[model samples]
Target: MKKNALLDAAEALLSEQGTQALTLTAVADRAGVSKGGLLYHFPTKEALVKGLVARVIEEFDALVAEHEDGAPGSYSRAYVEATFEILTGEARAHRRWSAIMAAATDPELAAPLNEAMTRWHGRAPDEDPDPVTGVIVRLAAEGLWEVLSHTPELYGTARLDALKQRLLALTRG
Candidate 1:
């Protein structure tokens, strides 16, 4: 519970105040926990980063799984569904992805981020026979997300929604 609180605080800081505010002290203060308390769960900033990355992976897996049930023989749709879920999910969901992906710039973080994405490439735990379209869906979604996060003026809401709907249809095959 304490650990999760720290992670949530970190995400909030990252989203609200930018990466510079994601210090241990800031996170501790945000969580209403002692600095020592934060350190007990995450010994260092790197450890805290790892926790955040883990949260990202965990959340992504659940998003994918949530869309898996009704997709019949293909998980391709699930990939798009998961993307849409993230894009349209609560602000924290979108912010979490942006924060983790941005944090992945550190050399130490690259492996874990890549590993999580690679695992995603392997498809959900249940094993979806068709995995190719998933990669495409992820690519398109990430591209759209990159724009939406950094340059909202590039795409209007209707256009974004229309594009997502079209992408979903394409991935259906």
Candidate 2:
């Protein structure tokens, strides 16, 4: 739909040009829609940003769900699987990084993302009986995500796979 197009345009602008270039006018132009059309979907830049954040969170949740099984530590395992996928997938990497940067710059914009993460992390303790191990695995996965976001070349594919496999193994225990 047109709303998705506008969101895609906004994400493209954010990823390609950075935050300063992500105005409503720029997004409207990029989507090949008129200003009124853009306004019909998203009235303000903040609303657009929230839409982007929500989309990313929804996509990530679906990815995690795909990895989930009816077992202990499933959420932790899914988190690791989903995080690794995002880190390695090119388009996903760009979209995720753009959303993260936008959220980092504005506290109000960060609320949705922060809340989603809090909900996920809260489930970790309940999903994995061994709370400490779950926390450790989650932290390790998150730490790698943060590091790679800055310096993607920090680890080669083989090493990254090894790390991912190790984390997944921990989830079984």
Candidate 3:
């Protein structure tokens, strides 16, 4: 529980202030725990980062599993569903996601991020679209996510609804 709390605090800080703003003391302070307690769980920032990466992967896997109903090639659909859920869910906005992404500029982080995406983009987890089309669609979706993350209010409800409908139709086709 303490560990999870620390991770949650770290995630919040990462989202709000990026990795450059992240520090062991900040995490400890944000989590409302002692430094010793935080250290007992993570021991180091790198370890905490690895933990965060693992949690993101695990969360992604669970989201896919929950929404895809065990079907193959369900990644796009799962992604759409999960994203909608994220946008609508009661949880805080995922600012940390952008921060963690920035942190991936480090060689160490780059490897894990690449590995995670490669594993997820393989046959079983994602759908088998035409390879070229899939690449295009995925890139486009990522761009859309960045836009949404950075300037969410720029998209009003109707626009978001329309984009969702169009993307869903395209993914289905």
- TM-score per candidate: 0.76, 0.85, 0.79
Local distance difference test, per candidate? Answer: 0.71, 0.85, 0.67
Instruction: List where candidate 2 sits over 4 angstroms from the true fold.
Output: 124-126
Ranking by TM-score: 2, 3, 1
List, residue by residue over 1-173, the lDDT tens digit for candidate 1. 37877887888787667777878999899999899999999998888888888777777778777877655434666766776676666642445554565466697765777887776666553343345655677678777766666554576668867987887776655
Leading candidate by lDDT: 2
User: Per-residue lDDT tens digits of candidate 2, residues 88-160?
Assistant: 8865566767787777779989888999889877783867868889999989988897787667788999999
**Superposed Cα deviation of residue 56, candidate 3 (Å):** 1.2
Worst 10 residues of 1 by lDDT: 125-134
Which stretches of model 1 miss by more than 4 angstroms? Answer: 70-73, 92-94, 97-102, 122-134, 151-160
Rate residue 86 of model 1 by lDDT.
68
lDDT of 3 by residue, 1-173 (tens): 46667888888787778777678999999999888899998998888887777776676668767877544335676766666666545442363364356457577865676676787566442354545455555556666666766666677778767776676666664
Best by TM-score: 2
What are the runs in model 3 whose C-alpha is more than 4 Å off?
70-73, 91-99, 124-133
- Candidate 3 vs. true structure, TM-score: 0.79
